[model samples]
Target: MAEVVGPRLYSCCHCRNHVALHDDVISKAFQGRHGRAFLFSHALNIMVGPKEDRQLMTGLHTVADVDCSDCRGVLGWKYERANEETQKYKEGKFILENLNIVKENW
Candidate 1:
């Protein structure tokens, strides 16, 4: 089990209601890995990233994005591919957009 750290401000993208931050972890990606990584939550909240940072697919945000309660800040993420958590995410639904905004990032 992990600590929720503390209550944070988050406007639910689903409900648009400010929610509390719980089980949020720092996320990022690793080099030379095959798949993406993410700082997952046991609460089943799908967190991606701002379109701006989405360009970077090798750093933490490259793998995933963890927003604050208000979508104002990135609180946590995973930056590697062999994160050991991919299997867990596979059971659910995770989508990575290949806009090819600039290519070479992914």
Candidate 2:
């Protein structure tokens, strides 16, 4: 019989709390505060902090910090609103730093 397999996931590096599913990944070419980041369609086990406008490489956008609910460690930010029409597609997306997350069940 074929072995059972579970959904692939990304976990918080600090506390091993599952944060995102591999299927939810939108893009992996995003830039984060530290370095490489990934844009995810959805995130789990996280908390969204206060929203504020910040100027990013693409343009000005309102975003909220995302933290791990279990460890309270800052994972990245979520785009609340995009100022430019071309960047509007990024709104409501979550960016998680590569350094802050580890792959699980790969």
Candidate 3:
């Protein structure tokens, strides 16, 4: 018989709650409020806060903070809308800070 392996995941650093999958990572070259961050196509076990417009390095964007549902720790933000056409690709995507997430199932 063969053993089963689960998907690689990223979890909240403070609570170890599964947040995003490694396979969902879109880009590792992103900047967060604290430091380096990763762009993910999807995230789990997270709650999106109220949307607000903020000025980021890329441009003005409407974003919402993403929090860990279990611990309510701020993980990152989700891009709700992008003002720049060149940055439109970020809309509907999520950013998970490297400082706030840990690798799991690897």
Candidate 4:
């Protein structure tokens, strides 16, 4: 069994860019754009670009792909806009499960 450490630190596997703390991880598995899977987090240090409009199960959402700041690898995406209700929580949120996370002893 895995032990529960304080706060797990995460970094981009490619460029070793600091991503977020495990405490911010909201979902371990999430289905994203084009049926892609991802790890959801409340906060992430990523670059979002090429905004696009997408229809989600909850509602219409304007999102953009988020990439690693250093390596420019496709990490996940950002929710730029959403319905009035969804926007309150979805906006500015990010996902980075597709990208590799560096596991190290801190």
Candidate 3 is scored at a TM of 0.95
Report the lDDT tens digits of candidate 3 across residue range 20-106. Answer: 999999999999999999999999999999999999998899999999999999999999999999999999999999999999877
Backbone collisions counted per model: 19, 0, 0, 1
- Structure candidate 4, residue pairs in collision: 39-97
Q: What is the lDDT of candidate 1?
A: 0.33
lDDT of 2 at 35: 100
Positional deviation of 97 in candidate 3, in angstroms? 0.3
Taking all chains together, each candidate's TM-score versus the true structure is 0.25, 0.95, 0.95, 0.68
At residue 52, candidate 4 shows an lDDT of 95
Output the TM-score of candidate 2: 0.95
lDDT of 1 by residue, 29-99 (tens): 42222244333233223354543323333222334444434444333333323224433342222232111
Question: What does the lDDT come to for candidate 3?
Answer: 0.97
Stretches of model 4 off by over 4 angstroms after superposition: 1-7, 33-44, 84-88, 104-106
Residue 81 Cα positional deviation in candidate 2, in Å, after optimal superposition: 0.1
Per-residue lDDT of model 2, residues 1-106, tens digit only: 6664899999999999999999999999999999999999999999999999999999899999999999999999999999999999998999999999999888
For each candidate, the alpha-carbon lDDT, in order, equals 0.33, 0.97, 0.97, 0.69
